[model samples]
Every structure is written in C-alpha cells, then in structure tokens.
Target: MTATLQPVLSADAMVRDAAGRAFDDLAADWFRSEATFPDDAARVRKRQALLNAVAALGFADALASPDAREAWVDAASILRAQARSAAPIDMALLLATGDRLASIAGDPSLYECAADAGLPGNAQAVLALALGRCLQICAALEAALDLSLQYVQDRRQFGRPLARFQAIQHSLAIAAEELAASTALTDLALACMVREGCASARLPGLLDAAALVLGHAIDVVYDASHQAHGAIGFTREYPLHRHSLNLLRWRDDLQRLRGGELRCAERLGDAALQAQGVWSAVTALMQPGDRHD
Candidate 1:
C-alpha cells in the first residue's frame, strides 16, 4: 500500500495544535529534572498527573466515540505526541478510562468484558492500545537513536569522535533501518484497520505483524544504541536509559499481556497458507467489501 495515510496526515496537523502544544509544555515542565530519574513511585504519581492532563485535552473521550475510525485516529495522535516527547507515562493507560481503566489497571472484576466491549465491541479500543503502544515504541527507538548519534559525535575515542568510525556508522544505520521498518509496519496496520474497520478478519494478523516488527526493533535499537554509548548510556543520570528501559519493559508487557506464547508468527504463517500465498492474503485483506462477517 501507499505510504500516504489520510488520517495520519490530518492527525499530525491536529496534534501540533493546542492539544499537542499543551502535552509538550506539560512534559517539559513536569519531567525536566535532568539531575535524577524518577523512581517507580514517582513515575506512578506522574502517570496520574498525565492522565489528568490528557483528560483535560478531551482525549479521554476518544474511546467512547461512536465513529470507530475517528476514535482510533484521535487516540493514535494523542499517544504519538506523548511518545515523541519521551514523557514518563504509561502509554497503555492513555486510552483507558472508567471501567476500562480499572480493567487495564488489573482490576478485571470491575469489567470482565471490557477487553471485548466498546464502540463496535471494543475491537477498536484494543487496536488503539496496540497502535498507541507501537507508536510509543517507535518514538522511544527514535529517541535512543538520536541520543546515540549525538553521543558518538561528541564523545571521542582513537583520536576522533566515534561517529567518524565506519563501524559505528554501520551500527547506527542498521538501527535506523529497524526503526523505519517498524514504523512502516505500524502505518500499514493502521491503514488496514481504518479501511476495513476493526472487525475485519485480517485485523488480528496485521496487528500481529506490527507487534512482531516492533519487538525486533526494540532489540536492535537497544543493542545498537547501548553499544554506541557504552556504559554511560545505561546510567540513570543520562536520558538514554529512560527510553531504553521503557522499550524493554513495554516490549515484554505487550507480548505477555496481548501475545501470550509469541504465536504471531505462527498465526501469520497459517494465514498465508490458508490464503494460498502472501500476495493473495494481503490483496484480499485490502479489498473494500471485507469489513465485517
């Protein structure tokens, strides 16, 4: 498919306005302590603050939107802004509220059906969570890559900056490629979801592909960036560790919570076999009339 996404285009512009500016401003003012990284307790407090800020921006109502496509777009854009800013908040909780919030927070008794409920039976809500988390991972990887590049340029070894070395350049290039691939997969998945609605049979497989791609990206980015910065990058004193640690945690949490046994690859393989080929599967998935059962 084409890289041009209409929702992404409009959402990008929309996120850059007041809502986006407010998020950025709050991030700067609230999490700008470079002297020390916040502890888990502190992070929890900050997350609540962020939840409030997001609600004030009217993003909390997105999951309730009657228009499934619009809800997904709004949630994705809001999460994108948060992740790109490297804010210390739980990206998963951004789309959760009320009973959904309770369920996502581990209080399953409050809403056992939440995972399978909402506009169009919460299929879009689940997609929004995955989509938001994917966007956040992409942002974290991008931040790590940027920090590594800057570190390599400034920190010298062997009579020159590390970035001058071809080996370092090669590593960073690989990191960049991984980031790009993960991002493209996410956009493609979003396009499929928007075009077919969250009820399409192909939605699960597309999101699985995105999750798998992002999972690989976390490893590649973590390795490349840490190798570039050496021991200094892992230290809490630097901002690199924040993105790196979050990437690791989020990857694991997403897999464990949503993927279970890493069956995404297997499921996708079965899908291709069922469709007779990868090309046929993809083409059929994008067809206009396959939105529902």
Candidate 2:
C-alpha cells in the first residue's frame, strides 16, 4: 500500500472554515424547526453530534496544547463560529474549556495545593469562558439588529414605514455602535491572549481585560438589543428571545465562574502594585521586538 500525504491549512483558516461548515450543517440538521427547541432528547443528541464533529477537526486537542497562543487563537475561532449559529448548543463552554477541565480533573489535590499552580489554567478557562460568552452575545445582538432593521422597514404606522422615523433610525444606530465596540474589544482581548500566551506572567492582566470587555459588552448589547426589539423581543415565538435569554443567563454564569469583575480588577491592581507600577508590569511581559517606542 502507498502512503498518501495530507495537505495542512493555516491554523486560523482551518478552524474558521471547518467550524463554519460544521455549524451550518448542524443548524440544518437540528435547529431548522421550533420543535427542536422543546425536545430535550433531540437537542442533546444534536449538541453531542456537533461536539463530536468539532473534536474530529482537532479543536479539542488544540486547546490543550502546550503552545498556549496557538491554542487560544484556534479556540477563539471555533467559539466565534459556534456563537454565530442559531443552535442552542454551548459548544464554546463544552468543547474549549470543558476539555481543559477534564484534563485537570484527575488530580484535584494538585490544583488545591499550590496557590499559583492552577492559576494559569484557571485564567485560561476564565478567558475562554469570557470569549465564548462575548461571541455568543455578539451573535445575538447582531441578529437582533437585523431583525429590528427588517421590522422597521416593513412595519408601517400612519401611512409611513417605521424606519422613516428618525427616532427609530437613531436607536438602531446606537445599537450598531454598541455591537461594533463589543466585537472590537473581544478581538483585542483575543489578540492579547494569543500574543502573550496563557502561561505568561501577564495572564492576570489578560483576565482583567477579558472581564472588563465581557462585562461592559453584555450590558450595552443587552439593553440596546431589547430596546430596539421592543415588546416582541420578550416573546418565546420570536427568535430574539432565545439569543437574549442566552446572553442574560451566560453573563451571570461567566461572572460567577470568575469571581466577578471587581475581583479581577483588584487582582490586576495588586499585581501592578507588587511590580511597583502598572506600566512597568505590563512592559515586563513584552519581548525585545514587541516594544516599538
């Protein structure tokens, strides 16, 4: 038998393409109808299938790699794609962070003994959780924005389209800005995590950054989306409610998982103080080539 060589793709491109195709296929197979929502058995089976597909693509192993930067970037791509889908599966939490948790679960004592031992992995998990939630929230907010735009354009009041009203347009514009800002922050956090690596001493700073971005993004996006969507957004029949509820629920879960933003901020502050100054602490993690000025 002759051996065949497989072609390799860039990590980011490979993850982005595979994740998109997988999620699209999953949505087609499972999320096509409202019946999928109420059926617990179907949802679980579909979600499991989705996870298996992602694992087959090597996403789970990438997240556990010793090369933290590459792992974080790959995980982020997978998470963003999962978030873009209308499917109810929390693949980001389950596939990305869950894999890491399982890896360390065999030895609880090791984690409990050293104060600084599990900090790196915990920080990574926390950041992953935040990234996943941010992507999910962004997806929901964008969907809400689309729905609002379509509604205002089609809905008429007093012989004119609702979109013709300056108030409605202004509200939507504000919502769009919030979404853009949130997405930008999420991107920035991901970039930092990939650049510095999870085991870097600046991991706490990265956690602090993720905490701030996720916290503020969720708040702004939630309020703006709900306001733009109005009464119908809360209704179960409307697709907006699913995204909104998920965002609301995940935000709470993320906060509790990481001890909230205040604690994160305080930890960063302490680290800065210990290093004598915040700027010095930040620069300490910088490589010789990283400093431009």
Candidate 3:
C-alpha cells in the first residue's frame, strides 16, 4: 500500500471493526501486487518498503511498555498486511509476535500496569499467544492456497483438470480442516486474551500447546494439497513453492524449537498434565548452548 501505517479507522470504533479495516486496506494492495515482483532484488525492496511502512505505523512498538493493548491490535494489522505483501515480512512479523509474548512472560508488572492504562494484561497475553499461533499457521494456509491454485490450473488425469474431480474435493476438505482448526484456536485464544482472568500466568504453557498442534496440522495440509495437485505441484514454477518454502521454514525453525511431532502427540492426548510436566522438565533442562539440530 503506502509507506506509512496510518490508522484508517478511529479508536472510537469497535476493536473488531478497527482491526478489520486496517488489514483489509493493506491486503488489498498486497494481493494486487502478488506475483508482480520481477526479481529477487525487487522482492527485497518491496518487503523493505512494507516493513518501513508498518514500523512507521508504530506496529512493532506495542512492546515499548507494559500497557499496549491497542498497539497489539495494530501490530496484528501490520502482520496481516505483511502476510499478503511478502513472505519474509510476514514471517518476521509473526515470529516477532512470539518475541513480544516472551517479553510479556517475564514482566510481572504487566497486570497492574495494563489495568491502570485500560489494557487487560491477561487478555493481552492470550492475544499475544494467538498472534504467534496464527502467524505460524499462516504457513499452512499459504501452502494450501498455493497448491490448490496451481493444481486447479494444470493437473489433468481424466478428460479435464484435476480440480474437476471428486477426489480433489476430498483433499481440499482434509486440508481445510487444518485451516479451520488453526483459525478456531486463534479465535479462542484471542477471546481469552480479551477477558481478564488467571489464564495469564498460564499463557506461555498454552502457547507451547498451540504451537505443537498447529505445527503438525500444517504438515498434513501441505502433504494433502500437494498430492491433490499431483506432479505439477512438485514443479519449481508451481506457485506452491513460495508457500511450501515458508511452511518448511516455519516448521524447521519455530515449530521444531518447541518440539515438533513429539510435542504434538503429547498435546493430542491427555494434554493438561502431560504439557505441564513436560514444560517443567524442558525448562529445567534448557541450557545456554542448547540447539535444535
């Protein structure tokens, strides 16, 4: 869109409406320019332009202090904007949300400070957690969208494109589950974040839990979408490559850090006690030199 993240909607408006418009405008510009990048340098320039715009909008400053609920809402707008604009920008914004949450985790003053400033700390925590989860899951949605678009354009098994097949419908149905699950969890987390509760203390734990589930669910969506798309789905020109790469990056980097398949399995069954115990042990075992691979 533009190089400044302006508040198109007034603060007097409901948060939902305000949040919706912020991203809608940027996304409009984003998708309009999708695939318009002529080269790698162009892509970098475009992403930098968007980041400067978002930062100018004061997007990342949400963590400047303990009381920043409005900033969080706006921060989310920047994220949605970058998600449609550029992959690296989107990944950076999403991962940054986690860093902000981690920053929240150690600040004990957040509760009273938030209350004094008309921001709800517990709810903010939930929103923060959901923000990170949503960003990570965006990789899955990207993968599904990429593969679905490519396959619908090119695969022909019978007398027509694979998109016309009943089996293709089944595949979409399965992949959509991942999309829906992540979206639903995000909504729940946001709701909890807005409501004041003791849940704040448990946010880090909740985030770890959601990260595990979303991480694994994304893989399912990626594999199924590619299968439905067939051989063309594997091609380099396939638009799926961009999204698939992002998914791979997220899975390998962020998801794996919290523990990937093993964490997912534990959360899938008897999550309450197992997650708590596992986090306790993992926290104890963590060292300065630890590495994922």
Candidate 4:
C-alpha cells in the first residue's frame, strides 16, 4: 500500500533570514581562526549549530504535525545559507533531515504510514529543491571565470599584465569553455526537474548532470584562479584559496565513493534529442522488476 503524506500546517512566516544570522556568525567565527575549514573544529561546530537549529524546527517530521510546519519553512531557510556556504555540507544536512522524517513515518502509531516510503519521499523532495538552488550557484561560479579574466587584463607579469601572454590567455579560454559547458548542462538539468516535476527515477540523471558540471566547474575555478594570481593564490591569506578548498571538497564529495557513483549512474544514459526523450529513457531504465507496471 502507498504510504500517505501527513498534512503539514501551512506556514506563513519564513525563518530563512534568521538562519542566515546563525550561518554568518558561525562562518565568521570559523574564518577568524585563520584555519582551513571542514577540518577546523570551529567550522564543524558551526555546521552542527545550524543542524541543531533545523532539528528544533522538526523539519524532518513536518508530515507528522501541523506544528512542524514552521520548522519546515525555517529549515528551508537555513538550508539556503548552507547551500551558499558549502555543498558537501548540504549532504550532511540531508542525511540528518532525511533520517528524522524516516523515523517518524516508520512509527505507525505516530504518523499512520509506513516509514519505508515516507523516508525516500521526503529525501527526494528536499534533494530536488537543493539541486535547483545549487545549480544556480554553480552557474554563477562558472561565469566568474570570464570576470576573473577581465580583471587580470592589463595586469602585469614582471611589469606586463598576465593577459598579454599567449599561454595564460589560452588557459583562460579553455576555462571559459569548460564553464560554459557546466552552465549550460546545469541550466538544462534544473529546468527538467523544476519545471517538468521530472519523475523520481530521472533524479539520478539530473544529479549526474549536476555532478559532472559541478566537478568540472571546480577544476575551472581552481585553475583559473591560480593562473590569474600566481603564487599569491596558494597562500593561506588569499581569499581565493579559502573558497577553493570548499570547491575541492565539494567536487570530490559529489563524485567520490560508491554512493556518488550510484547517484551518477542514475543519470548516465543514452543520448537523445529532446529533454523529454532523455527523461523517458532514464525513467524506463530505473523501473523495478515489475517493468511493465
């Protein structure tokens, strides 16, 4: 039997802005340590704080009670900052959020449904929203390659702006091309999911598109930044390097491990002409043993 979704109370006020405050405080404090984050205790603590804030809102359990609605909305807001700050960390948030919802749904007495279906249902919806938001950022970051090149123009290497050199120019050009591909592919994937309400089976294809684009964008950003800045870019004091650390981790997280591989497999499929054709093929590929069903 299909597990039903419980009615969540309609939430009017959005708590995303408030969560921004939490993220800012935590992020600032972590940066103050002048330490590499993710590995830094301050950064971990900051992420945990955000996780606690969302848990307080009972976002994962939103389907259980109308009372959880406010938390759900608030969790979404906190998620906004997390996505802006770190994408891999978003995976951590998803695991936490998905777990709670699954627990509630599994409790027949509490939610009146099987946990099996509800858990994945909640995960799917949340991930869809996340993928869309992340794609927007992904596109913007790729665009930065062009802007970086412009800034480097008239900039001198030994009294000459590095842009004057053929090698540097060619590197920048390649970075731009790479970014262009990332931007176009992500835009297309997000459109498929957001507008079409693309089927669950098609999620892997969409995420694979995201992974490929995101992974490539990281290399583009890292390479272009160094090519533009030289030795200064590698120093701890440099802002570019700080952000690049997160980019490196995010690329690895999206593509590394068995889980990541499976996620990409969900998307890798035969090429087709239209978006609909692609999704149709992916969906069919994902069908269960009752293939005809």
Candidate 5:
C-alpha cells in the first residue's frame, strides 16, 4: 500500500467536536426530558447533579485550553447545546469562570468582573462570559422557533395547516430575522474578540451593539412563538414555556447588568456620533487595527 497521509484536524475543530460530544452525552443521560421538579429542593438537587455531570464531562479541561479563542468557541458550543435542552442549569457559571465574580445581588448571570481593573485578564474573562451567555440566549430563541415552526406545520384550522397562512408566515419570518440579526451581531463580536483579544478597546462597543440587538430579538421571538402555539404555549406541560421563561429571565438580567440597557444604548449612540454614522462605527469596532479618530 502506498503511504497515505490522513488529514489532521485543527485544534479549534477538535475542541469544538469534543465539546459537542460531551453535550450530546449530557443531553442523552441527564436532559432527556423537560419535566419540572416538585419543589425548590428538588430543583436544587437537579442543578447540583447537572454541575456534577458537566464536571465529569471534562468541560473544565476545555475551559483551560491553551488557545483562548478555541476555549471560548468550545464554551459557546457547550452553552448553546445546554440552552437548547431548556433545562434549568447554570452552565454559564460552570463554563465561564468570570461569572463567579458577579457582584449583582440576585442575578448571577449579570457580570461585574470586567470592571475590576486590578485583576489581570478579568476583562477578557468577563467578556467571554457575556459572549457565552449571548450564545445561550440565541440557542434558546432557536429552540422556541423550532417548536413554533413544528406546531404551525402540524396544526390544522378549517382546511389547511396554520403554516399556510400568510400572517403566521410573516410573524415567524420576523422572529427568524430578529434571531439572525442578533446571532450575526454576536458572531461579529466574537470575531472581534478572537482577532483583538476580549480585552481589546473595540470589544466593548461591539458587545454593546450585540446586546442591543439581542434584547430586541428576545421580545420578537417570545411573541411570535407563543402566538403561533396559542394557549398551549403557556401551559406548563408544553416545553415552549421553559425556553420562553429562560429568555425573559436572561433579558431582565441583561437589562439590569452594569449600568443597564439604557446606558448601553446611550454608549452605542455616543460611539456612532463619534464615528459620524452607525454603520461606520460598528465597522470600525470590528477592525483589529483601526484607530478611530
């Protein structure tokens, strides 16, 4: 046999694949159902179990990966998969070390670690945590959309499926558009982080824009999904409520984080004005070497 060379996967690809497999195992073993716990104690037990399972899956090793960018990519993948399950787990805190520094009284998801100037690399770690949370939100929105799409396609009214209606299509289309825009903004922010490190001066602006877009997306996705499923969506038996509730909680946490949503909007507006336009401002924020005047 002639000597044959097998292609070697890059480190990033290997990391992503390992994270995906770990999540798949978790979903199969732990998140097989969307059933609710009987009480707070039960819920706490399940949460603790989830943390143990995640730890067993070697996520900590992935988090400590040498390549910072690959480590984030792996974390994002794991968080996204966990969100899609609609399981009540604080994967963010488990995967994102900086989230442990959350100074918020009630909301652990809202981070304040980035502001601690005395801590080395705290800014980058906080930024990574925020980005990972964004991925989770996006994944939850995607699950809701997927459920709504399936419901409409199967539901019949009069003589045809609800999906045949233009109004339903329009609503779903708007939801998808919002989701896509939010995801794209987050991806752009992640790209900026990969190119310029999460501590880059340009990162905060991109993150602000991503957060602004994601806030709007959560609203649109929630309305459209519930509207599509009608009363059933609100029922505890239906799984849609799980993702919806998660989205709403995350939205509130983001709004309350740091200086709040209004401050983020104000900062973005100020940056736009400084750059003379919104498009130019966002474009400059994505550039690794751009020295904005």
Candidate 6:
C-alpha cells in the first residue's frame, strides 16, 4: 500500500516569536530565583508551577498531533531558554516523556498497543527527551562560552588579556564546535521524525541517532565548557556550574532510562545487520516521502 504524505508542520514567525516571549516571561518571573531556593521542597514547588505554566501554554496537547513538529521545536526552545537561565525544573523528561505518558494513560497495556501498531512509543519518547536535552545543553554551552569569553578578556595575566593566549582560544573553539555539532544533530533528528509520511520502522533508527548525538554531546561539550572556564567553572557562585552540572546529571539520568545507551546501540546494530548492510539499512530507515538532497 502506498503511504499518504502529510505536510510537515512548522511554527511561523508569529508562533515562534510568541512562544519565545511567553517562555521568557514565565522563566523570568518564576525561575529566575530558582538558584536561590532555600531547600529541595521550595525548588520542587517552583518546578511544579513552571510545568503547570508550560501545560497551560498548550505544550501537552501539541505532542499528540503527528503534524505538530513545530510544537516540538518550540518545546525544545523553551527548555533551552529555561536551562540557560538555570531554572531548577527538569524540563527534559517532563515535557518529553511525561506529557506523552499522561496522554496514553487511558489505554491499559499501552506497550502492547504500541507494539501491535508498530509505533515504538517508548523509543519515540526517549528520542524526544534526547532532542530536548540536546537543545537545552546547546543553550547552556552558549551561555558558558559567553561567560568564559568575557572572563578571559577581562582577567589579565602578565599584562595581557587571557583571551590572547592560544590555549584558551583553542579550548573555547573546540567547545563551540561541539555545541554546533550537537545542535546540527538535533535538527537532523527532528527532520527525520517529522518527515512527510514518517514510518514506524524508522522510529528506532531515529531514536538511535538522537541517543548517539546526545551521548557524545554531553561528554565533549561538558569537558570543553569546563576547560574553557577553568577553576571558576567548578565554583557554586559561578553560573557555569549550573549548566555544566545539569548536563552531567541529565546524561546519567537518560542513560538509566529504558535500558539506556547500550540498549539503543544494540538495537541499531541489530537493525543494520538485519538489513544486511549499513548503508542500505540507513537508507531504508528514511521516510518514504523524505526529500533527497
């Protein structure tokens, strides 16, 4: 049977602008003081409120629509902005997996339903979480990069700006490259997920792609960010630790979810072997209506 093509959904300038403004305002009003919370309880309360606000903004409903790819993009942007501001909320799992689980709770044995339908729902959820985390990490890295650049330019050693040192510049450059690569991988994964007439068979491969990108990103980006910031990066007073630590924690958390990275790699290898060739396997994973460049 020939698969019907569905138009890819994208947020226009107005939608993007509105989402950006709303999330910025919400983050500023509620999460700006997250780092100053006296205890875990207070932090949890604030995080709940932030999640409520996100739901009210229609994020929960957006994930239910197959064509709501733009909603996913907006969700990622919101998470990224929140992380860059050091919001104490767990944006990655909350929006990515939480919303989907809530939506599917009415069905008892949803896993069986997913299997029968060839949906791979759990993998899709993980893929979404990974993509959201990637965007968040990218934003956090950008903020760290900005801070490091400012510090190196201002702090002088031997009557010269630290930014003039080749070593410092090289480290920052490497961090920048990792950040860019992570962002690009995120974009590619999203494209594959939203391809016109996306197929269930492609879901596992897409999930694997997201997992690999995020796994690599967390390590390289985290190290480079810290190296760029030097000793100050580790201090609690410095904002760099906020992003760096969260990225580290989230990577580990994701690794624990649903048999994690090792399982994802195994599934990818199995699919490739079943297809009989690596290149053919990848090509077969692409959506029927996807454009070739």
TM-score of each: 0.70, 0.62, 0.52, 0.52, 0.71, 0.66
- Candidate number that wins on TM-score, 2 or 4: 2
Worst 10 residues of 4 by lDDT: 105-114
- Candidate 3 lDDT tens digits, 42-125: 344345444333332333234434354335545544454444333432334334445554222222122223234443333433
Cand. 5 TM to true fold: 0.71
| lDDT per residue as tens, model 6, 185-259 | 665565654553123345446656656666776677677667766788777577776677666555543444325
Which is better, 2 or 6, measured by TM-score? 6
lDDT of 4 by residue, 1-293 (tens): 33676422222233545676765665566455645556633344344433332332233344224233233334444544454444222334333544554222211111111122253345544444334334434533543454467657846767888888888888778877776676565545444343333343455565676676667667776777676877766664544443565455335434541146445655364433333587666565443322111
- C-alpha lDDT (0 to 100) for residue 226 of candidate 1: 97
Order the numbered candidates by TM-score, best leading: 5, 1, 6, 2, 3, 4
For candidate 4, list the clashing residue pairs, or say none: 16-77, 155-161, 156-160, 156-161, 157-160, 204-267, 205-266, 205-267
Per candidate, the number of residue pairs that clash is 0, 0, 1, 8, 0, 0
Q: Candidate 1: misplaced stretches above 4 Å?
A: 1-14, 21-68, 88-123, 286-293
How close to the true structure is residue 144 of candidate 1, measured as C-alpha lDDT?
A: 92
RMSD to the hidden true structure, all candidates: 8.4, 11.2, 14.2, 13.0, 9.2, 9.7
Off by over 4 Å in 6: 1-17, 24-61, 88-126, 196-200, 286-293
**Candidate 2 residues 1-293, lDDT tens each?**
23565322133657776866765665565444434455444344344433333332234234534554556555665656665555553433444444554222211111222123243254555455555555556666676677778878877877998889888788778778877876665665555556554444454455465566666766766676666566877665677665665555555544544576788778777877998998876666333224111
Sort by lDDT, best first. Answer: 5, 1, 6, 2, 3, 4
Please give the lDDT score at residue 42 for candidate 3.
32
TM-score, predicted candidate 1 vs. hidden true structure:
0.70
Of the two candidates 3 and 4, the one with more favorable lDDT, higher being better, is: 3
Candidate 1 lDDT by residue in tens digits, 1-293: 46664453244656535555765665565555432655544344344434433332234244434355555555555556666565543434433433454323422211122232332244445554555567668878888999999999999898999999999999999999999998787776666555566555666776777778889989999999999999998665777876876676556544543454278778777878999999987676555454532
Q: After superposition, how far is residue 66 of candidate 5 from its true place, in Å?
A: 7.8
